[model samples]
Target: MSDIDTYKQQGFGNSTGFGARPALLIVDLQVAFTDPQHLGGGNILAALNNTKSLLAVARQCGIPVAHSRNVFDSVDASVWCVKVKSLKDLTETAPASQIVEQVAPVPGECIVRKTKPSAFFETPLADWLHQKNVDTVIVAGCTTSGCVRASVVDCISHNFRTVVARDGVGDRALGPHEASLFDMAQKYADVLSCAEIAAHLRGALPG
Candidate 1:
């Protein structure tokens, strides 16, 4: 059998189902990753486009939207930063660490500042979702192999139906991007394309 067919047969590509009133979670689509000139930068233009559509659809459906970014303190960064010797770089004051323009969080949207890969770790993400009464979470953004993947696992752990937009998340390496998506689909979350998510939002089953 072809590799693709073999994977499908093993349920490695099974689609995770969506649910009513899905909340949108956009993770770490920051300038550092989008600029191609900073640490962790990647080929992420296509991913951004996909996420733009997701954002529009979520707004059209009146769904709650939240965003996450990684920022550290200039004076005293998180322990992870100190341990990794990256404390001086990820300061909260750096514009490079901010979310990219195309998908920047609008005023009043919940923006969670994280010091680690998982959005829920040391952040208010879980309580915020609970407050919003979110049943499902549609996730989009960059570095699928890192923060995005971490966030997906945490989303599931929080008991939220997690949906990772397949094309809407990118990584510095194509291999990790593809491999991590496969891993997320197999155990952590539903990984779908923007089109698939749109269909679900429109009350249709995604292929």
Candidate 2:
């Protein structure tokens, strides 16, 4: 049997399924990570497009949306900047730190500025989601093996039903991207395609 089959046999790949109310959580799809010259340049564009499509459906369905961006005013603020030099580019005033225009936040959407990998860490994300009555969160964004994975784990820990859009999240490398998705699917969240999520949203929403 394949590794996935073995995992299934061990009862590791169970689904938590969807919840009543869902929100979109876009994590760190910033210019620093989307532009090749900066820290981006992979299959990230495809993921961005998929997320854009998902965003449209969520907006039409009137679901809550939240975005997370990693911004540091200075490298002295955290030791993480010392460890990962690329993070230095993500300053609050830098253009590279801004969320890409494609999936930019619209009016009334919550924007969470975080300095850590997990969106829920030291942020008001949990409180915001609670206020919105969001039971489920559809997560999409860049660097699947990093911030995306961290945020998904935190989402479940916060008692939110988490769904990771497979095509809507990307990484700098395919190996890490695929590995992270498999890891999340087995333990943390339901991994579904953006199209699957859009279809479900269409059916779930009132006309």
Candidate 3:
């Protein structure tokens, strides 16, 4: 038996069905993380491209949408910053702080900012989702081993049904990205392909 088979036998893998009202949470797809010349590169390009199609469906379906960016007002002395000094340059006005154009937020979409990995940490994301009556969150983003994983755990913790797009999240390394997705699927969220999730949302919502 494979590791996945072992996990399934151990009762670690079970489906967490999605809820009626689903929202899209695009976490940290900013230039800093997406562009090849920036701190993160190469590996996440496919993920971002996949998200473009999913984002269009979400918008058309009127599913609540929110985008998270790693824009920080200050980063000095923070444990995260100490580990990755490149993050300090991701200030409000920095080019790297800007969301990539391919999946940029349209008017009325919530914009979440955070200095840490989880977007929900001291941020208005949870309250906003609550106000929208969102019972499920569909996630797409970069650095799957970092912000994506962190946010997914918190999304479930907030009593919301969590779903992650399988190809819509990426990392700088393939090993960590795949590992994080597997762990999340077993523990925190349902892992589905972006295409499937988008189709479900469209079918779930009325015309």
| TM-scores vs. true structure, each candidate | 0.87, 0.96, 0.96
Determine the backbone clash count of candidate 1: 0
lDDT of 1 at 159: 87
Clashing pairs in 2: none
Maximum-lDDT candidate? 2
With a 3 Å backbone cut-off (N, CA, C), the pairs that clash in candidate 1 are: none
Model 2 segments more than 4 A misplaced? none
Arrange candidates by TM-score, highest first: which order?
A: 2, 3, 1
Question: Residue 40 lDDT in model 1?
Answer: 57
Instruction: Quote the positional error of residue 15 for candidate 3 in Å.
Output: 1.1
Q: Global lDDT of each model? A: 0.82, 0.93, 0.90
Regions of candidate 3 where Cα sits further than 4 Å from its true position: 75-77
Segments in model 1 whose C-alpha atoms lie over 4 Å from true places: 1-16, 82-87, 204-207
Best by TM-score: 2
- Cα lDDT tens digits, model 3, 1-207, are 999899999998688888889999999999889867776764699999999999999998999999999876754237888898888888899998999999999999999988889989879999999999999999999889999999999999999999999999989889999899999999999999998998898788876
lDDT of 2 at 151: 98
Tens digit of per-residue lDDT, candidate 2, span 86-169:
887788889999999999999999999999889999999999999999999999998899999999999999999999999999
